[model samples]
Target: MSNLFTLSSKLAAQLDQELMGPKVGFTLQQLMELAGFSVAQAVQKEYAIDDLNKNKKVLVIAGPGNNGGDGLVCARHLKLFGYNPVVYYPKRSSRTEFYGQLVKQLDFFNIPILEESDDWLQYLKPEQTICIIDAIFGFSFKSPMREPFGKIVDEVSKIDNTIPVVAVDVPSGWDVDEGPTSETYITPSLLVSLTVPKPCSKHIDTAKTSHYVGGRFIPNHFAEKYGFKTFKYQSTEQVMKL
Candidate 1:
């Protein structure tokens, strides 16, 4: 597995652009749906609905970008899988047509969507929350996080040891290729890499972190075009544990 190519931040963005371009013609919604669904599948694989007799309440911390959109979709599927998921979406995307629909689906499912407030921390109870999905940032993220997200990352770091946090793509506040560059960065117990494993993944402490790769939408020719090896996912699986 060490021989597998880990994409740098630039390459990761370029690959995404290529996927969404006319060559592949895949829409952002399509990719987000698959990526989010794959993440939910990874969650089910790691934390079963009845695992260890713990409660099924999951706290999903969503950002305002595409990664957050993935979280929104993930929460919807988690509910369908019978897990009680509550979303903490402080900032939302302005693309109402897309994000609005995702939000509507969550509302239709009767899932709780918590917005930013002075006492937002009250919703994040480690004892009551079985798992926390870190969807606050992705590979496109850079250093020096902004306002509430910076504070949010700090709080999540404090509770990292108490709750099992599953980071979507790159961990929040981490340098896309250099790994953790700040004290506010979160080290999630499990990481679900989308498309390809980012170069920063080399810094992951394999002994402490359970890594999984999802987003099985890359075509074989695309990998050849990019000169990266395609991962071999198990039969009919959307995600594979590494």
Candidate 2:
């Protein structure tokens, strides 16, 4: 019942302060890993009904940001758990070093990366129940989706209603700081919010309108000093305690 929007300004200020220094002590890679681990933990707990893992297929829609890095990590972990996750990345340039590293990791894992011209939609059968992981965009995405990304979003939206979607952070195309735009977006069945709950989570029109799975809010100090904070919402255990 906590209102995350009320703390947005404060959180934004803290984030700015943490990034103003010469080097980001806590690299985005570390955050992406933590986010991925947190989501894997949450999904394992929530979807443990009658050995459902045996037949489930996971589809990850990743972009070129830290958000996509998180999805790659999730795909790796999911594969280790005996699930094959088909990862789809739109043709785009990446700005984060962590994202580039994740792309390599995905390749190492032999995870198929779908391109815009691949006709990947044909693989997703209407009756083939799967979980779609939306990591296409995050809080920093401000511009309206265009071209291949827009086309990808449109294709994924056609997935059957029986298929559940797990969105990483905010849903793809939904603005985190602001509310939802008229642009295309995915309405995930569950949203695993990393670090802290995004402001859009509170908006009724946002894509994260269903169940929310909260992740740890790792303070910069944790990365700088390898010290844990006293905050109760910084880890999966802490979130479960809530």
Candidate 3:
């Protein structure tokens, strides 16, 4: 497979700003909706509902950031697309208006929203889940994961590799540009890089991991402004494998 442009964390943040600013004028809610939908499509494409065995559950471990919101939206869509998804969002963000709306929507779907608990591992076990969505961190995350996430990543590392872990954006505990610095970093089976892949995309083991680019909402003007190399998506698909 070919590669796409690798964006630094700074450039990524600036792109987000431009996308939301007056020129592009996209609301955060709108972007998140599209991103989450794209992610759901990718997941569905790779792990089809008909192919799943007796277990058809997806475990989405969401953080407290916009990535978490994307995960929430993804879980909701996955439910509509015929998969049971359970969300483990321990620390909800202070952006109550937006995140609360996501929660309300999940409630409407009757998806299980799990909080931080001692028994979190019960759901993380390979036999318990068909797939694991790691929506904990993004490119903005720095080294040394804090609080429950550090502990959570440790658990993720120990799970059986038979169950695929699909990381959203960047894998948790990995440096955005430098890639995995620690030995214990979680190795995702598949990575769904939103908008554009980060510089650390090169660090992932291509032979062992599958990477795809989602979030096809980037405007042409901004792409030109950043000198982003044009890449083709198959037909009308929102995501393209890289």
On TM-score, the candidate that comes out on top is 1
Steric clashes per prediction: 0, 0, 0
Q: Which one wins by TM-score: 1 or 3?
A: 1
The stretch of ten residues in a row with the least summed lDDT in candidate 1 is: 118-127
Cα error, residue 2 of model 3, in Å, equals: 9.0
Using lDDT as the measure, the top candidate is: 1
When superposed on Cα atoms, how far off is each prediction in RMSD?
1.6, 4.6, 1.8
Error of 3 at 191 (Å): 0.7
Model 1, span 1-242: residue lDDT tens: 46657888888889999899997899999999999999999999998867653554898999999889999999999999888899999987886689989999999999999888735576466667878999998888877798789999999898888888999999998888889987688988999999888877888888878999999998788887777767899898999988
What would the per-residue lDDT of candidate 3 be over residues 153-240, giving only the tens digit for each residue? 8889787277788888888878888888755678888888888888878888888789999898865666777768545778888888
Better of 2 and 3 by lDDT: 3
Question: Of 2 and 3, which scores higher on TM-score?
Answer: 3
Evaluate model 3: give its TM-score.
Answer: 0.94
Tell me the whole-model lDDT of each prediction, alpha carbons only.
0.87, 0.64, 0.84
Give the TM-score ranking, best first: 1, 3, 2
Measured by C-alpha RMSD in angstroms, how accurate is candidate 1?
1.6
The TM-scores of all predictions, comma-separated, are: 0.95, 0.77, 0.94
